[model samples]
Target: MTVVPPLTRMPHLRHVLAPVLAALLVATVIAVGPGSSPAAAQQAGSPPVVVRGGGWGHSVGMSQYGAFAQAKAGRSHGDILRHYYQGVNVGGANVPGEVRVGLLQNQPSILVRSSSRNGSQPSAPVKVNLGNGQIDVAWCGGCAPIDWAIAFEGGRWVLKDTSGAIRGEGGGPVTV
Candidate 1:
């Protein structure tokens, strides 16, 4: 069998261990409190000291303050990312032509309302029921309301007009 090098030499392992090592170091320093002997504090039976640290983001990844300082000192986006995250090659990658992001996950339903600009009255709100698979679409402003029935059938949402004809089939988002 061929011999393999240690996993610690891997870039991803190095990146993962660096933060853990830093946290352990900080914890050790705090446990052995500065300006006071640990034995003395234990003998006095004093309460645990609470130490507050600075910065706005979590310590699992790149530090917000560290990135801000780097940017203030004239660092590019790629430079910052490379500095924080190892095993990542920045730039020279193919970019996607289009990106679709799905929002409002786990929401039972959604209510949409029309607005009139410049201190005008708003129209009636339309309710889209996602959990039960039904939608009540509002037609126009100030006219007799026409309700269009839409339901989820066979894993796809089908929109039907007033005459009960299948207009279109969609997944989540519906357009009237």
Candidate 2:
């Protein structure tokens, strides 16, 4: 028999292995469809990939459980708030001004009203109308309307202008 070089000692080993490895990778990808976890796909009556976690409200800022733990560890309420909100002065002061309240409803309008500390006639109710996909800022006693065209880009809401310049962006509730 003619002496043949071993696969490891062959000059074209890389070329021979490249296509084989690529085919294997493609086959593996096809076998495991996108996000098809074995536990998720194999269950007889799985509840559609249910994710379980624990937390209340928006999960932002200080948590109630955290405060309870801190209090149990001999930390006071003031200490807890200070720890949660760093570099912030936690105190109350008396300021004299009319309290303005803006009530935003499910509809695209804000009912604006103001009331003074002392019993006085409340300001006339003003309805600030916001157009569809339009965010307005109260400026110079009028609404400065910014027409936003929002789109889902890269897994987040991207607020863009008519010229496609990104103005603002957020994944959750956007104030502006």
TM-score per candidate, in order?
0.28, 0.22
Lowest summed-lDDT stretch of 10 residues in model 2? 96-105
Deviation of model 2 at 16, angstroms: 63
33: Cα error in model 1, Å = 56
Q: How much is the lDDT of residue 96 in candidate 2?
A: 20
Q: lDDT of each prediction vs. the true structure?
A: 0.47, 0.40
lDDT (tens digit, per residue) of candidate 1 on 59-127: 445676787799799997567666766555555422222222213324442323333444234464455
Task: Highest lDDT: give the candidate number.
Answer: 1
Question: Weakest 10 consecutive residues, lDDT, candidate 1?
Answer: 93-102
Candidate 2 ranges with C-alpha deviation above 4 Å = 1-57, 94-176
